[model samples]
Target: MSTNTTDIFTIRAAPGTDIWRKPPTTNICNAPTAIPPSTRSTGPLTSFLSACASFSFPWRERYDQAGILLAFRRRSESSDSGIPPKWIKTGIEFYQSQPQLSTVATDTWSDWSVTPLLSSLPGAETEQWTTILVEKSEDEHGKSIWVYRVVVDEQTGEEKSRTALREICWVYGLDGEWDLEVVAMAARPEKEVKDGEEKELVVKVRGWEVKWEE
Candidate 1:
């Protein structure tokens, strides 16, 4: 099989920019507005197979994050209850003064998980680039989406190892009436710049790949 990779690009996320949903009417969807059209992929939910990307950014301040986002929205206008779309975002986030692999899945509400970056892993010291893959998978029980932290070779950009981070089963149930959009995303939830500050979080994306159904 052949593989495709995009050239390096940057995404600037303003302060207080985030993508989150919560109970009792808390929905924030202000992060992807900065993304360029060339970096986004959209299709029917059933047609989406997988999405992968490599991201790097300077870790500064609280609630800073950069990663791959998979968003799903209902296709029919009547089925839409005027609610926010379901989404999954996985990547490296700045927490506890360090970078950690984090994943957040949103259905009716948002749930988050985080894992430490082990020192033994490749490129863990510099905390430069982190690769994440979100793909469709199935087991005897049912269909699901798997989130993986992929370690790639610095020289050849080939996969060296991958660790499973999360498995979301609820997402596939919406395939019958939903469309999917995948893109690189960045957010800074706690740092809003004041007047004339000119400060923003810039995330460097090394590459992005999306697989679709044949």
Candidate 2:
């Protein structure tokens, strides 16, 4: 079976140097909210930290108008044989009925799901995570910037056995104001299975950087 994780490719940043947008949420396991000492999760911090140790972090931001935080989470809740498993994206700005991000005055918006890719095994040593940040340049026409990153661990800062596509913006317009432009986005794939292994996909994003696998 043909696969890409083992296939190496080179990726380089596009021309025109620019600044980078830091990821909104860092401590992925923890919710990005001002939880008072009294309202904080009573669970052991070690447990939360342990969970994050195996999975990649997520993105979190608040709606400008509603002041609701959109906490984008990744991890599988349940799985059926031969399936990739199911995940969810829950937060203040997401509507259960419409399931769209709450953008300023916009009520209906689309939500994203983060997938888990920890190597499944019996008593497999605790899996590791990798994290990375991709800097994207905005088009003069104000098109959505493309964000690409490699998932890695917190301690080692190593990427996951697989790579994923992520994009985040403070606001797409002037002074945190979102322009809301829709364009054909270059897909950052998570469930890519170029080869036959029931596992991760590692492929180069053209002119970006070399793809790595664990």
Index of the highest-lDDT prediction: 1
Minimal lDDT window, size 10, model 2: 179-188
Give the Cα error of residue 92 in candidate 1, in Å: 0.9
What C-alpha RMSD separates each model from the true structure? 3.6, 20.0
Candidate 2 lDDT tens digits, 1-214 = 1111222232221212111121352111121221122211212111121011111112111110011122211223112222111111221121221212212111223334333323322222221223222233356565332332344553564555434344444323323211111100111122232354323211121111211121
lDDT string, candidate 1, 1-214, tens digits? 2133568888998888888888888899888532666667877787888888888886666778999888788886424534346889889887876688999999988999998866423432244778899998988999999999998998988999999999999987764588877888999887655567446888888768888886
The whole-model C-alpha lDDT of candidate 2 against the native structure comes to: 0.22
- Residue 42 CA error for candidate 2 (Å)? 28
Which run of 10 residues does model 1 get worst, by summed lDDT? Answer: 118-127
